[model samples]
Target: MPKSLWKIISRTFFFLLIPIILFAEVSGLSHSMMHKMELLVLQLGVIIFVAKGMSILFEKIKIPGVVGELTAGIIIGPYLLGGIPLPGFEHGFFGTYLALNPGATLPVSPELYGIATIASVLLLFMVGLETNFSLFLRLSATGVIVGIAGVIVSFLLGAWTGMLLLDLPFLHPETLFLGVISTATSVGITGRILTERRKMDTPEGVTILAAAVIDDVLGIVLLAVILGMIPVLNDSGQTVNWGYVLRLGAEAIGVWLLFTILGLVLSKRISNFLKIFKGINVPAIMAFGLALLLAGIFEKAGLAMIIGAYVMGLSLSKTDLNYVIQESLKSLYLFAVPVFFVVSGMMVDLSVFSSRTIIFLGLIYTLGAILAKILGCGIPLLFRKFNLLGALRVGFGMAPRAEVALIIAGIGLSTGLLSRDVFGMVIFMSMLTTVSTPPILDSLFKKEKMGTTEELLPAESVVTEFSLPTLETVEFVSAKSLQLFRDEGFFINQMEMGHKYYHIRKNDIFITMICKPNGIYFESSPDDTHYVKTLMYESFVELNEIINDLKDITKPESLKNDFMEGKDDKRVDLRRVLDPGCIRLNLRGSSKKEIIEELVDILDSQYQITDKKGVFEAVWEREQSFSTGMKNGLAIPHARTDNVGAITLAVGIHRKGVNFESLDGEPSRVFVLLLSPKHKTVPHIQILAHIAAVMSKEDAVRKILDCKTPQAVYQFLTESEG
Candidate 1:
């Protein structure tokens, strides 16, 4: 079928079926008909499926996936499609028991809400783990000022806007909740944009990130105080006890500060404690156990559970175990986090937006939130190192409010402080800021504008960078260095598996290693600068020794015999990649190197290789490590290199035979060269395995060598294999 036709059919099918699914009259499972567990399981499956689908669809159009997840919830919630009757359920799959409690704002069932609550905790914990504590400290002076200013301005403006528009008092819980929501800035969104633009290392970018971290911390503290105050005001019955309220606020702040300080001070000790488990996942699971325990403690102490989770994560952020826990819990994070966002979105009553007054209030609230960040964060920078342009860049970077804002809004609605209409307004403001800020921020960074007039100060840290020939070499060095560090009493954390990024620490020393396509980059404090250099020196020394051993063992006359007898059994069709233009029947070279070069030249002439020299160097280096010569008069010289954009092949037939260091101590007659993109492994291995299988057949090499023309060679290789 044609791709265009298939696409049209798929589109038409979905277009026609969507309405039926949305408004179907089939009976859905009632709480009495099925166990809550069964219903909850089915509901979760639907939520995850729709959430992931919407996320992918939205990402295709250049919007954030989080927005898509939110939309997924709104689409399928009790207020919309979720309210449609379905099979076994009078209410839809995602329907809530809100009919039992007409005042309930949350649309999901208690079990689903319980899961979303845990998801919120995990999400905030990750936020804290990702926060760079060292960078926060280094930029403390400016960051603290900018962050505090932004929070203060945003809070006041949001509260004022709520009061002016909603006719609420300044001290109303709804008004205060609005202020809390405004104080959040999603640096994750901003950081992604900066990294994509290659501006993450810039002064403005760094300042924005640092300030945003501060914003998160202060915002949480404010949330704690507000949460504490709400009870005091309610109990006082419009005659609040000023002294108790002040004391309650003080206690909240004190408890938060005390836990944070204690956590940071004992973080390394806690890391050591968890390491006692030693099991692959035990340590990560135990760490989460600590988070849960602290979350409960925080709730008991009259603060939000997420605040405790964040504090615990912030403390562990400096430990080498940070990445390990992050890596281990990633599956849980992916599964749980989306549920929280979707549930938050489900709480939005689309019915509330029908009122023009509510819509106008939401629009005005969003505008105020935008300008608040600009005036607050941007104005502070003008008095510091930044010019107006730089300040604006930083301000825009701090404007988006995503996960944290949603979390706060959810809390407000759950606590019954925010009505459905007001909650909708908060979500409306958050979505607008998050969706609008990135493009404006990206545009502001179009022309290069320095954040400072004076030359930026030299970094107080040291970086040992190694630009290896290929990503394979970088990985090789990384694995060796990790082992070496572990032996040296340093805990090693692979930042993200297969990403070639690592964080290693021991005692007072900490180091970060990043692997890019071009090189390995290591950053450390000046105090531990020698560790990176020493580690690399040792890795290269080991590499050299390995190379020397390879040179001794893989010589043409010294290699093992009977290699073809142990051929791979897997079969792959060579015709899909085989090209007649890349095959050469006659080759003038008499040496292994020369023969390989001749084959490479053919591929180059066919425009199959992008970087010829790079491909040559890779092939040569790989050959030096271990010869690719088979025992049955065949040589397959291959390299997975960035020099080729795809799977490329070249066939060269050397009639007189070349000394290609064959396994059976015989000269090689048939040379099959393969070069694949470095990032791909499966296809490279499959093709190599397939070639081995093909050649192991009766008289395969003889049949290939018998060809007189390039077309004959190509046809034989492709046809005989199939």
Candidate 2:
């Protein structure tokens, strides 16, 4: 059978038979006596069409198609103008409408229920699969604390708002359930925003992601507890069964735990099994089967079908099969998910807004949601010294609600704790938050920059020095520093030198040198800084070895004898024997030009003078004329110059800061001078790369500013490397 022909036949069969079946049901045919298999076939077509149309609409609007699909359901159901409202069609096709409406009902049957269940489950599983646990773990402790605070605060606020707005008795069980639904934050929306903004790796992003995960788990538990109290609350404390509630809670937890463990184990096995498919379509089929089975299991366990679907997704997440599953399910999700959302939208009785009670409830709930996050996540950061802006940013980042909101609302409706109006309002809130995030975040980070050159050198008084005397010597340095030198290497020996410098004779060529005076300085260019930093760091290791040798030689006889006699209970403390120093250097010049000129002349007399602009241009031109003015008040003045004989560096600190066109639009206070040999085999660029990495860290920059002496600066740099 050709694919096109099969599709046509499928369509024809569905179109021709659906109306007949519906007419039969409406015309008083008994459900048990009637064979409505044709209606099932027709429904498949309808499901596919709605799914595809909703997906296309969502794509056009840049919203998830799931929203569209749900909207479609609402449109075709009793909630909207398009809903057919055939007597039996009000409920799901297989719902009680058929029995209740008899001859007036549509002929849709329950056979399609399995497919709907499967779709919902698989959608959730994919949510779990997409989550990155490691990224969640990396959020700073402050972020974690803030996230917890947000969840608690938001939940309480939501609960309180529910209590006040709900007209039901103060002690009504449904009110508490409504509160739980209101407090729910959808991880899906937050995840999408983080992904879109490329902030998933940042401190704020990771914290939000982790907090949302924990919040979901906690919310579900709370929902169960609330639901358990419903029967007693509704019956006015009559015939309450605490034991049953406890048993249900325990069972739910056990099932959840068992499922999680099973997912982890099955993920590994599934990954291995997928490998056998090689270039075949077996993986897709296997995934589909697995999705179905998981959904069925979750449904059996009395949890939402999506929970099982999400577990299945998590199981496949660690496997190569995940991408395969995702791709295969894309069409289904695009179609079914939108049906879900559109239906939700259709259910929105806008008339509810006219009710002052509903309006007050919505306002109160929204306020609670905002306040909960601010107080929960933001207040704790004040003690950590984060400014109000930073704390607010963190809180706002966690504010959006998404799919989880709908999930909770659905739970509310199913359990009869909330009316359709309340459920619709909750959905409205979720949509508002979800739609608002992208613009809010874009505005917040529009001026934010990353990986700027200014971040490489943050201090006003810093120096970096580099030396390349011979080819072998350069090779040694390059090997130790891992390609700190990127040009030619030559050996120099028996040359005159001064206290702070050395003169070198490479073959017949000679290079002059000068002693660096206490006030004068020489540092590696930004390019060479990494190499010099690495060499300085390696030198510390050698110093430690020398110290150990001295300690062995100077050991007291009694101590040595005690050790040999096996009477010593403690090991020698090497750290106690070493003396550490701190360094700070501050230099002031009339201008950046005077500073660079004076510092360069002091380093060496023979070194050629290069214009700052020319040097900047040279470095930029090499990498497509890029400026290394990484914002945040730092600039790395680097160039691969031919004027120097070796890979050299000169660091100049500007107390007044220099105009280096930093990305952050701030003055540059630190400069790294880079000199690469005209030709060399060593990768000198690696040194600069490493140094940039070190400087990028906020804490490291702070430590650098705290140094009080040259030796201290050296020690800080060396200790930081470790």
Candidate 3:
């Protein structure tokens, strides 16, 4: 232990000892009252200390902090701590003696259960606060399919396991709860591992997370139906009251239906209402209060508290208070969540080890947990054209079971649906799944090297837009081959010396281009399926465009009027626009905005335009919408507006490229800023094309870059073939 931690521990121990000594000396207090106070002190002092300490200890050993918290409760629990005699006290302070007394109900104070309940409620609320409801509707096809498959398979397997072991009837409460536990996985552990491996944003990792989220939603609905019907189990607990069970189930579903309606109807209202307390943290507090209210409503309506909490989160998911609630409620999550885990651990009686049946059932339950997730989640991925390796990775990623298991097992134990031995077995199954899944995932992923997909994205932030355009081969081989793709408006997310990657919006489809000395290579994501045909067609279209462009480059003189618009009788002369005074030689502006201002000034000063501000605003506004920077260090910033009397043009050169947020990753060295009256820039467009074509050539760009003054640049541009 650190010296600071040791000091704090020693002081905490001394202070707790003082409480006992002080309380014992008081003579007026009743025995039970004294015991209550003493126990409260023990819970506050010992429970919190041991829980936090053990969580730290367990975390160091690569086990989850929850495992350590639970182990701490077990060590100090009646099965271990209270099994031994203590000095002075009637029982050991570690636990209330219960198992030692036959036919005795649990002696644990109701206050402790109360705390655990609060922890559960808060934990669920935090989950709700963090969840993104819209994301469910936006999940890719593969994600949706995998999630449903995982749920269907796991739920069936779990129900089968329960029926096989217990001889339960169809739709039995015990059988259904087993299936519920298996269906809802805890993705946090696996998610963190993906983050460590830098694969969190990769196709496989992204699909697993999206699938997990989807299943959690589906699981909540399944669990609600099961819990609602549990009340209809008959006197013998074998047969169910069909009408009553159906009615109860309907009522549960109705509550959720009403919740959805209210959430949709009231989302904007909630956001507007939260704005009332804009300067204060009251919005977050009220958001939490709303979660509690929803939780209470769900509980009263026959669903679990967590279901209500999750619904409340979904309700506020579209609200602006989402991030505020998360940041503010983090302290509450940290303080209260570990208590629920530790208290749950304390509830696990080690006496289950004495029963061979419990051991056997626990092992079988674990087997069902692992195989169901693998077969269930993996098979769908493979069917959806995911590679075998990717299918296996996603399956294991969704396998760890912790949070949902504990919640369901607790519900079962509390409702008398499960016995102590069964509860212990369930908890063991939860721990087993969580502890064993990671190593298998690690081994599987380690053997096949992770792709460069993760490396292309920003590691620390959520990057929405690529900062620059894709870079291509010097021969423009990939550039020409990717022209049709570029026109389709895919985000050029990543680029290297000889490669580029493009992502289709709001979908899992990815395209990668690799340029080789011989030719170019093209491929799309999920290469195991027919999607490759789409990739091939796109590649074919771009190849044709590339061939046509090469043919045009060979016959450059034929392109002078190619990109022109409606013909004008008074078309402005291209050579006149390149006058010495109109060309800015080695312009010194540092940003796109600054360079634009300098170029616009040349046209304004030379032409004496009446509305310089209007012309600048029009040009700047167009640039702001999207970069006018063409590929290979050329930009044609043009605006057609009433602000300018005629089609006017100015050329500016920035040797040190101003990032116009250009498409090409290089600084734009050549600019063609055009300002025209409303409706016509036909001749101007033709001139802009000629400038772009000339800039595209190596010798032409070299001469422009080597220009000594504005006269030299003007001379070169005017003398050059249009």
Give each model a TM-score. Answer: 0.86, 0.52, 0.58
Winner by lDDT:
1
Model 3, range 622-668, lDDT digits (tens) per residue?
A: 78766777655677898777776666678888877777655546777
CA-lDDT, candidates in order: 0.82, 0.54, 0.69
TM-score of decoy 1 = 0.86
Kindly indicate the candidate among 2 and 3 with the higher TM-score: 3
* lDDT of prediction 3: 0.69
TM-score preference between candidates 1 and 2, better one:
1
Q: When superposed on Cα atoms, how far off is each prediction in RMSD?
A: 4.5, 24.9, 20.1
Model 1 has how many clashing residue pairs?
A: 13
Tens-digit lDDT string for candidate 2 (588-672) = 6654455455445533443343444544344555434445544444444455555444455544455567666556567766555
lDDT string, candidate 1, 1-722, tens digits? 45654565466446534534653554443456356787677678777767777777777677888888888888888888888766456665566476555666677788899999999889888888877787777677888899999999999998899889888788888888888889899977898789778787677877887898778877877888888777667632355678977887788888989999999999999999999997778888899889989989999998889889999999999887887888788889999999998988899889999999888999999999999999999998888878988899988999998888888888888878789999899888888887888889999888876767754545876888889876667778877878888889876667543456678877677888888867888888887767688878998899889889988877544433333554553366676677888888788998878887898899899999887788888899889978888867888999888778889789888888888877778889988998889765548877877776677778888988887888888877787654
Report how far residue 596 has shifted in candidate 3, in Å.
49
Candidate 1 residue spans exceeding 4 A from truth:
1-34, 99-103, 197-203, 231-239, 455-458, 465-471, 495-499, 516-519, 544-560, 568-570, 579-635, 643-671, 696-698, 704-722
